[model samples]
Target: MPISSKIARQMEEASWIRKMFEEGVRLAGQVGAGNIHDFTLGNPDLEPPPEFVESLRDLVVRPRAGMHRYMPNAGYPEVREAVARWVREESGVEVGGKHVILAVGAGGGLNVVLKALLDPGDEVVVFAPYFPEYAFYIDNHGGVLRVVETDGQFRIDFDRLEAAIGPRTKAVFVNSPNNPTGVVYDAAVLARLGGLLRDRSRKLGRAIYLVSDDPYKKILFDGTQYSHVFRHYESSIAVYSHSKDLGLAGERIGHVAVHPAANSAEALVAGMTFAIRVLGFVNAPGLMQLAIRDVLRACIDPSVYQRRRDVLHGALTELGFECVKPRGAFYLFPRSLEPDDRKFAKVCLGKNILIVPGVGFGRSGHFRISLTSSDRAIEASLPAWREVARAYATV
Candidate 1:
């Protein structure tokens, strides 16, 4: 009764993933953690890559003078320059320090972008089966979320996407190697998307920015081709996190890079820096900003996740759970045996196999299993997964 109705509604509407994660903790306690396979959270269990570890250690052992003091709301100039160099190499854009704004994490960086772009009731389009928190982030800045469903392969259907864009449309969010499906958006796909947005923006007579949530850009597998979002769209913004690639989820380090080619690009960066300060993020942690500057070239080997993906995807597919083979990231989205994903998720819970239902990702009829768990957890979960599949077949 003390809480506002808006928050209550948000609680009811989303965070199924976090709810399931909490449930996993409780069940793990009750059943002994070994008895439960938690596939709820995408929190990685991998150690930070050795290069990242070394960089942090060196910086910590010999701190720079005033290293702990506040930095430019945009970030340490040198660190931003380093990140700019990394982005230039990856995105093929000649970005400079002025183009980047460091932030607490991808989540914080997203909020910064949304705050900078949205006016009240402005609409932001997102792909279906997106990260659930996107809806919340949109609302935090008084923007509306418009979801456009993807095709069976979880790739964009341009017609559907175009239909979703209209007056009041401010931006479109692209998340490649997507959170639940783990499918990478290829260069061809991005090029097509860029074309669609360009035509639509021309008709609407305004810039429809493309904001990419690219935390998993470095987690590619099977020689997955990486497409720079900036390469495809001039009005694009890239928000990246060290959470996935560096296994620094808890460290909460990330950056936002406005496409150097974007119109009013300098003003956009200035606005984002203002948002960072007022949003109370102030800036990304100083130590992390400095530490990662030297280790931009290294990330956790994709093979570390490729092995887990192979084990999990192969076993699930073998057991008759239809799934699109994931080429990147560490999640598998498989069709739920029943159309009611929440009901099916409950059934998995009965077997101590925890998964987030597809509804959590703005899609239904499927559930997500995160490979961020240990190899032992994946191996152990298989028999239980097999039992669930067998039971569902008869039903």
Candidate 2:
């Protein structure tokens, strides 16, 4: 009764990840916290890399005049320049600061993008098994979400994608080294997607933007190659966050980069800058912006995550759980023991194991496990995982 009816309804359909996380908290009180195996959130247990930590220490120890002052809505010039160089290196696109706008993180950058691009009733097509928050983000901008299910291997079903696009379609969003399912989109797949968008844009008489959320681009595994959106499509935008790569989740810093050759690229950047102000993010945190700028090339040595993935994925499969090994990101999405994933998650909960049901990501009969747990936590959870697996095993 206190909140708006809209938000009230939204809260009812809130993220299962948070739901399970809260469940973890509630259950932690009963069992010693150490006995709880909470794979609910994608939050890494790792600390920020030494490079970023030292950079922050240096900046803090030697404060400059106006370092904490309000900056341009786009961001500090030097920070933007640093991000631009990183963009050029990773995406193979010749981008400059003019093409970039800093934001409160990939989440906020995405909201800024939708705020700038979406009109009332516009449609944004998303693939199934997606990050659940995308639905809320699209609704925030008065856009309709059209979910197209991926193929068995989590690859885009091109035919479904073609059918999903209509005259009012504004954009197609993708997250590589995806959230729940860690499938990485390769350049070949992107090439096919670019061709499709080009053909569809001409037929629809509008440019349908390919909006890529690449917060985990640098957190790849097993030498997996990441395809940058700008390199695959001309009418595209990229959102990058320092959270995953730098282990700076609480810093709340990231940037949006519009493809230099995109349709009305300059105007798109300007609109996003304005949206940044109107959305109240104004600019990314100034101290974080400056700190990340100095360590633009630094990352948390993704091998750490790769090892985590191998440990979890191997143990699951060996125990008869079916899952695709994650090529990147710190998650393992495995098919649930039964047809109902919620039931499976409840079973996991019985063992003091916390995982989000895959139905939350628009899929059923699966569940997500975050690989951000420490070796100790994983070791402790193995017995519980085995116990749960046996509970569902055929007698």
> Where does model 1 exceed 4 Å of error?
none
Clashes of each: 0, 0
Alpha-carbon local distance difference test for all models:
0.90, 0.90
The superposed Cα distance between candidate 1 and the true structure at residue 268, in angstroms, equals 0.9
With a 3 Å backbone cut-off (N, CA, C), the pairs that clash in candidate 1 are none
Look at candidate 2 and tell me the lDDT of residue 163. 85
For residues 1-395, what per-residue lDDT tens digits would candidate 1 score against the true structure? 99999999998887676678788888988999889988877888888889888898998888889999987899999999999999999988899999999889999999999999899999999999999899999999999999999999899989998788989999999999899899899999999999998888888888899999988888898888889898999999999999998989999999999998786788889899999999998999989888899887778878978999999888888888889998888899999989999999989998899998999888899999888888887899988888888778832
Models 1 onward score TM values of 0.97, 0.98
